[model samples]
Target: MPVVTTPPFTISSHETPTGLLRVSLSGEFDMSVGDALSRALVDAARRPGVTRVIVDLEHTRLIDSHAVAGLVAGYEAAAAVGRGFTVVNGGGLVQQVLDVTGLSEVLCEQP
Candidate 1:
């Protein structure tokens, strides 16, 4: 007998009084979940008084190229509006992928 497992991916968000929106993303980031995330980010960025956006990926299990592209696109869109965008709590494999793809520099990272 064999067992199959499903990848986990979810996005939750909230806003701060300072107009910074924080979105916490968990689980695998693949083509299956890219569009959902893209839509969420786009909507958040378009909201009034959203001067900054932070994507917390501390619990993210995996991220594929499609997800990476989505992130880049989201970052660019936020930048176009003069809004701050950042990715935080990514380490280990996730960090490596971002570094190899040269997206680490393009996307802001928390200290």
Candidate 2:
């Protein structure tokens, strides 16, 4: 038998005084964590006095379509409730995907 190890996948968050939930995501933003991402966003958006969701991707190095989809889902969820959602620190491969998919400005604010 062999032990399998996965890449780092973590999510850290905080709430701002102005009704914003700021989330930081690092490691591989792939399918494995996609659902978690969506759920987290939805939870944050649905929080009392929460009018915005911001995700920081300063340490994210890899991503896939599933991740993109999750992010879009989060954005949609936020927008439906009059809440704002944006991604920042999008650099490297992550930035490329966001840009190529035409979601750079719509869903993200590059740093």
Candidate 3:
């Protein structure tokens, strides 16, 4: 029998010419990385010249309640500074959870 391990979570950010700060997340997103996510979101939103923060969850596999709280906190932080915050590329259970929680409507980018 072999023990399996999940890869450490990662957060990457880049700024677009259009004043958007794109933050991409990868790996399981749970309580373990909630604080990091929150910090990253707030930092991204507060970056000079950034008008919006787009969270890309395309590579994020799992998201827990703590993670959801972090997202909400991030949204609030961005809003306080007159910045926009939204999420994209969430699928499967991740999307379902967001939808069920009503965050999909509030935090996701509209099609």
The top-ranked prediction according to TM-score is 3
Off by over 4 Å in 3: 1-6
lDDT score, candidate 3, position 107: 98
lDDT tens digits by residue: candidate 3, 18-53: 998888888888987788777777777778899999
Candidate with more favorable, higher lDDT: 2 or 3: 3
| Cα TM-score per model | 0.87, 0.87, 0.90
Cα lDDT computed for each candidate against the true fold:
0.79, 0.80, 0.85
On lDDT, the leading prediction is: 3
Clashes of 1: 0
Residues 1-111 of candidate 2 have per-residue lDDT tens digits of 011124577777888788878887778978887787677766766677888889888988887898888788888888888999998999888999999999897987645
By lDDT, the better pick of 1 and 3 is 3
Model 1: per-residue Cα lDDT over 1-111, one tens digit each: 011124577788888899989888788889987887777776667678999888888988788888887788778779888998888877788888888998888785635
Model 1 has an lDDT value of: 0.79
